[model samples]
Target chain A: MYEFEFVKPTTVADAVAALGEEEAQALGGGQTLIPTLKQRLAMPATLVSLTGIAEMKGVKAEGGTVTIGGGTTHGTVAKEAASAYPALAALASNIGDPAVRNRGTIGGSLANNDPSACYPAAALASGATIVTSSREIAADDYFQGMFTTALEDGEIVTAVRFPVPEKAAYIKFEQPASRFALVGVFVAKYADGVRVAVTGASEEGVFRWSEAEAALSANFSAAALEGLSVPADGMIGDLHGSKEYRAHLVGVLTKRAVAAA
Target chain B: MTKISMKVNGKEVSGEVEGRTLLVSFLRDTLGMTGTHVGCDTSQCGACVVHVDGAAVKSCTMLAMEAEGAEVATIEGQANADGTLSVVQQAFQDHHGLQCGFCTPGMVMSATALLKDNPKPSEAEIRHYLEGNICRCTGYHNIVKAILAASGQLEGAIAAE
Candidate 1:
């Protein structure tokens, strides 16, 4: 790990000021950032810790929406959001195991936007809004690609607002080692229409499947997607699975998610 | 360098450490509390589990300075005041839960937290809660037995001990 200055701020204003330093990075949960630092993949002049801000850590559910603070750990979300949004809570409960859930945060997960991450799927499928210190961006405009987002330099995410869906479910084929999604699908049914998001298989990162969304929006059943064929081109292929295999799993899991919902 | 102060096993301690120093190193090297083992450099292994602010967390993935002013409890603190084994520890012994004993501390810490949250968890719950802690020795059968026994859900074997 590289030598750097560590700064912990008790408020958002102080955190913003600390992050303004040259070559400084915002630290949340440190589940990913800490390991990145140890491997010398990231070398910043200062480490701005966001765990000290009391206001940015909790969950509130009311008025047809569930609002969660950016710094709230996965454990808190798993416990608190169970009654209101069981599918989202189950996704949080199953991420990385008990230890990793205690430290990893939703804001950090969405910001890092790993190709295999589960939160991005949930957010996009549910039409959750990503709230930053400056503006609120819809999930459609938030994710750009793998390990990337639309976040500007030094911008801090304060919270996320999720519109409560009539029904939603997330199902993933976990890569046993890291518990990350091999090809996860989240199906959300709203009053207006149904939204389907797929993660871990796309080279372009988490993306919405308009065909499945249209099919499920009309019928809302597994049989509605009987003959749809998802193209295998541009899908991620590695030691875990082949592109065609993942493409097949994508169709299978989407049906499973819709059936479960 | 960063100066951090925190409570470890009911004692207030302070240390000056580099920003890059992990909490596991601070506990093992700086404070000489070597009971928390580090099995993997990555965060996959749960060998370095510890309690921070009354919640179990992986110490290897957090910086030492992030634990400032927090309460931390390690494997060294799991014993009774008279030096006898804790119920979770005794159950492990009574059930022969360990063969290599490398993942015992992490398993115990995770079990303690799980029972605190859900005291009378079912068998499936115990297995789900231990998803992070890996035990290559006993194939996890005895470990699950020990955890169920520790929770007082088992009847014959652990009750006799």
Candidate 2:
């Protein structure tokens, strides 16, 4: 790893100020960034450690909304929030493994926005708000593409607020090597309507399958997704699964998720 | 450079390390606690698992400075002061849970923490909880058995001494 300056800021304000420096990255769990740096994929001049900042941790549910601190680990969310958000908790429980869940944070997962990540699908389906230091971004607008996000330089995602759904479920077909999703579906029913988000099978990145959503909205049932075919035009293709396979999986997992919901 | 002061194995230790220094490196190099091995540079392997403030975490995936003022427990701390092995450690040994033992320490630490939180976890729950700690040897059947035996809920099971 390249030599760099380290600053442990005790407050969010201080952490934000430190992050404003040229080529400084906020260290949240370090489940992703540290490995990237060690492999020479990222070379930041400084690292602003956010662990000392007390505010960026915990999970709270109130007023039909669930707010998770940006620094909250997947394991905590899985074990602690299992009763309130079963799908999200189950999704968290299945992430990488116990150690990964212990070290990987929800905010880091969102900011990094890996193409096969599970949290983005959950966020999009739950209609969560990505609250940052500058502004709040809707789940739809937050994700841009694979390993890409709408966050500008120095913009730190502080928390995520998910509106509690009447019912929700997330299901994924994981790639054996990395255990990332090959095709993941998150389904949620709000007071207004049902939302469905798909991850891990898009060349343009995470997207919603409106056809499946429309079908499920009309009647929430597994049979509703029987004939739906997600377009293969911009879906991702890899050795583990072809675009067609992923497209097919989108329907299957969507049906399974709706059934589970 | 970052000056990190934290509790390791119940002792408060302080050190000044580079920003890029991983918590595993800090524990092994600076603190001389080499029990927490680094199996994979990426966060895939659980060889470097440790407890940060009573929660199991991957030390390799975190920076040393991130653990400042936090309580950390490594495999070295699992044994009693009288040199008696921890219940999980004894379980692993008696059940022949490990062969090469590269992943044993981490496996034991993670399982210990799991049992602490959920004392009466079922067999499936034990397997699910240990998904992160991979072992190439023993096929994990014995590891699961060891954890179940250590939990002390199984009637007529001999304690791994």
Candidate 3:
């Protein structure tokens, strides 16, 4: 790991100011960033830690919306958000393990945007709003690709607001060794319609399964997806699973999610 | 080098470390607290697990500066002032939870954190919580028994105590 200047900012404004420095990166949870650093994958001039900002650390639920500060760790969300959003809370509780849950934040998970991560599926399926230091980005727009997001340099995510859904469920087929998803699917039923987001299996990263959404939105049952199939062309293939197997799991998990929802 | 100050093992300690210095390095090297082991540098191995602000966290995954001013606890702190082992630690010994003893510190630390939060965790819960703490020697059976015994989840073990 390369030596770099470390700065802890107490406010969003201060964080943005610190990040404005050339080649500075915002640190949240440090679960992913620190590991990446240990591998010497990135060398920045400064690290702006958002953990010190009191304002950017909380879980609030009101008016049918659940808003969580970007700095809030997965443990907090798992404990605090259960009443308001059980599915999201369940998803948070299952990430990594007790130790990982204590240090990994929702914001970090979303910002890092690992294709196998669980939060992207939830955020996209729930249509959560990601609030950055400068602007708010819809989940669809926030995720650009694997390990990528629409975040501009110096842009710090402050919080994520999830409009509570009437029904939601997440099913994860995990890579046993790492606990990351081999194929994970989140199905959310809103008043307007249903949204299905699949992760871990895609080459293009977390993507909404519009076909299953259209089917489930109309029928709102596992049986509705009886004959549906997700294409294996763009699915990720690795030691854990084949592309075709992942595609099949995606469909199976989505159906399970809808049924659970 | 960055100056970091925090409470470790109930004592306030300060040290200067590189910005890239991991919390485990600070605890093991700077403070000379060798009880915390680093089985794997990567976060997958829970041998580096410790209590930061009363929660179990992968010490290797966090920078030392990130833990500045936070209350940190490690395996060294698990023993009584008289050098007697902690309940969690004693349970492991009583149940033959460790063989190679490499993963003992992390297993004990994680178990302490678990029992602190949930005084009486079921056998299933013990297995779930031990997901991060790997015990290849005993195949996790004795380790799980130790945690369950420590948590008072096993009636026979409680009677033995």
The candidate scoring highest on DockQ is 1
lDDT by residue (A133-222, candidate 2, tens digit) is 789999989989888999988777789999989999999998866778999999998878889999999986788888888887888888
List pairs with backbone clashes in candidate 2: A203-A236
- The regions of model 1 sitting more than 4 angstroms off are B156-161
Error of 3 at A230 (Å): 0.7
**Regions more than 4 Å wrong, model 3:** B156-161
DockQ of each: 0.87, 0.75, 0.83
lDDT per residue as tens, model 1, A57-156: 9999999899999999999999999988999998999899999999999999998999999999999999999999779999999999998899988888
Model 2, B96-137: lDDT tens digits are 989999999889989999999899898789987887787998
> Best candidate, lDDT-wise?
1
Q: What lDDT score goes with residue A39 in model 1?
A: 88
Instruction: Please give, for residues A1-261, the per-residue lDDT of candidate 3 as tens digits.
Output: 888999988999999999999999999998889988888899999999988999988899999999999999999999999999999999998899999999899888998999999999999999999999899999989999989999998888889999999999999998888999999999999999999999999998999999999999899999999999999999999888999999999889998898788
Cα shift from native, residue A197, model 1 (Å): 0.5
Please say which candidate is ahead in DockQ: 2 or 3: 3
Position B44, candidate 2: lDDT? 79
User: Model-by-model lDDT, in order?
Assistant: 0.92, 0.87, 0.91
